[model samples]
Target: MSVFTAVTEDDLARWLGDYAVGRLVSFEGIAAGVQNSNFFVTTTLGRYVLTLFETVARADLPYYLHLTAHLAHHGLPVPAPVADRNNEYLGTLSGRPAALVRRLSGRWLTDPTPAHCTRVGAMLAGLHLAGQSYGRRQPHPRGAQWRAEVAERVLPHVGAEDAELLRTELAWQAQQDFDALPQGVIHADLFRDNVLWDGELIGGVIDFYFAGTDTLLFDLAVTVNDWCTMADGSLDAARSAALLEAYGDERAYTEHERRLWPAALRAAALRFWLSRIEDLHLPRSGEMVQVKDPNEYRRILVARIDGEARLPDRP
Candidate 1:
């Protein structure tokens, strides 16, 4: 129930006239995401998801929409934007930039198997390969520079132990040679919920808002941290192995990426931990919102720091 903007039936019906999506049969606010105002829109033609960008700048939106369209065109399972008569993928509704995309089938798997991880790994590599010629360049918004800035902002609110840990981790990450690793467009946030599954196959990889240019290993780190973790925040060795092996089959990991894998995992955990803490103390308002527990990533970060979870050796 994270719909921040309300769209009345009359307003939506009028909006539908611009696109050839047929008459509006029904529409309701989607409750899953925390960023945009999403609705499950049904029309006489097909089912689609309409999203109203809330925090995203109107000018910066073309990168996301066009990236999605490009990925879909390159045979990846992504939500392609539904264009209006003018061949424009973006429009305005409820005083916010909006766009419609075909709704994908299947549900997110809460309890994922190694097979599922394998599928995600392969598809992620495919996504990176597909974006080799994407043209547009958007740096990772939550990269090291932003993380350092936000750490100072959130330090005053956290406990002394947490603050010290944050400083140490950030300083260590800053010293790493991430430039040597392979670089490409990455889904910076590839949490389980963002991926849709039809049985063991990935129906689609949704939520491209956080995507940007970064080391390929960082992207893999983000995926493994969430998708390959057990309940106790420990990395599941089998699942991690499956993911890395499958990913390597598509795009072989460079020796540099392999060497920096551990640091990348640490960086991924720290990124989420800092962002979650900020979200908890400095909150944002939305029509319907749910704040995730910062402690979850804190536990994952601590585990990574303790050298308890290591990715399986490159196959």
Candidate 2:
């Protein structure tokens, strides 16, 4: 389950009717994601993941479907979408596009250690290397583009006392001179919940809704912040090292990328802060959802930039 929502057996049966793979016997809501409603469906034949689109643009799905197929073809650990009887991978359900994916058999670790971080880091590197050859794809604009929403939607919702701090930081960041890092197809969001584990090993990755064309190092920086940023808003050096080393082993960082790490980390944190704040103010009904605290990421970013936190070594 990816989101905190409900899915009934009848809903699954109706959705699975178009598919020839199996007859749906049971279904359950998946509670791990915050974007769309998800269900773990079991059939006479096998298990599959059924997602009911919430706020996602149907136009944006081709990138996810094609990207997952491309990575799977390259032997990376990604879920493959199953086709219906008409050979279509996407189908309409309750006025939304839905798809059934082969269920990856694994458990999501509630508490991930450094070892899990290392494996996930390696998996991310392999996923990126395999996707380097994929056809060009673009990110869909957030319901509001990052800039306008950050200043308008997000700022108005934050408490007045904390608003000035974010405002100051945002203003400073906007004026900073920085170089554009390397560009590629990037999995911009790689949270631990998106990774599936079997015992102590990483089984596979899921959720490609945030995949897009962006600075490659920027994507790595996002992963670092999500997987290695600590509860106290500091970098977990040991975990960060494991992930960065794993990523560097696949595609060694250029001197430019190395130099941009600090800035990129801050930028990534700001991006999530804006997105989470936006979501908090505009909650969607019937969508499996949660409100993330943007302040946590902001604290981590400030600490890193202020030299109070240690950064991972450059390779």
Candidate 3:
């Protein structure tokens, strides 16, 4: 996470007064991501991740914080947001809307095996299942509308070939009836880096800022695109099967979902490609900011259009 808002030790020590998590022991900025300002906060009681919202508005904060709490309450391995003395999960620190959640154990896997993919698939299905009862309803921040807008915004910054691809894909996706598919709250950005693993088990899932109401199949497609893809942007069959099979065990996919799997994969790839291009061309100024290559997802979008991936059969 980028450090958009820098907080001094003195600043954090004072902010800790409103919480019951004891005195602040130490705090450091997280530098891996480019979205929010994140810090590894250590207090006398335990470890927590403090996030200062950068793009997310203060009013829309409750939907994310409460969503995590809701998932944690349902026995998922999500980090529970810590409520302050005032019984609120959100707080203001350093003039930015912020939140703190108990940091769970383990690290995100960089090179995940099929077994790992299986666990992620199962957990994702469980997440969608648990989200059925969530009280809040927010449209996915990077859903269809955002895709069209962002693709248009970034087209002028790219070459002619990429611009044509964007236009073609945008038109194709517009004709899709994703709203007709099974819908619910989805973890729209369930990439490999977001899931922490403790040995054979998934320790925790983080970064719920992108979670919202969307097609459950689209969510699965997003995960598959990240966790099951290869260096050349091709899908690895073993990992794909492991993940989709495990997911189907929990909530079986309908025939309609199966029929639309290829299009959904293209939709997922296009969204991330648009986002990466936007980040690369129209980036925000922040401490330790990282902008990933837009070309990686660009290759994936092309590969998906070539029809290289499909829902794998269960063993």
TM-score of each: 0.96, 0.90, 0.98
What's model 1's overall lDDT?
Answer: 0.88
Model 2, position 243: C-alpha lDDT score: 84
Task: State the lDDT of candidate 2 residue by residue for 1-315, as single tens digits.
Answer: 345345556766777788986787777777665688787778999988888777668878877888888898998778898888888788887667888888886877766778887888788888878878999577624311464456576667788865886677677666544436667777777887788888887777888887887777777878888888777767777888888887787788877777667777777777777777676687665444557776777687676667443234555
Cα RMSD for candidates in order: 1.4, 2.6, 1.2
Which runs in model 2 stand beyond 4 Å of their true positions?
1-8, 140-148, 175-179, 308-315
What does the lDDT come to for candidate 3? 0.91
Candidate 2 clashing pairs?
Answer: 1-30, 2-32, 2-33, 3-33
Q: Each model's C-alpha lDDT?
A: 0.88, 0.74, 0.91
Per model, how many backbone clashes are there?
Answer: 1, 4, 1
Error of 2 at 147 (Å): 4.7
What does candidate 1's lDDT look like per residue over 1-315, in tens digits?
278888999999999999999999999988776678899999999999999999888888899999999999999889899999999999999999999999998888888889898999899989999999899999987788888999999999999999999999998999999988888899899999989888767888888888888888989999999998877778898898899888889998777776788899999999999988998898778778777899999999888877654444555
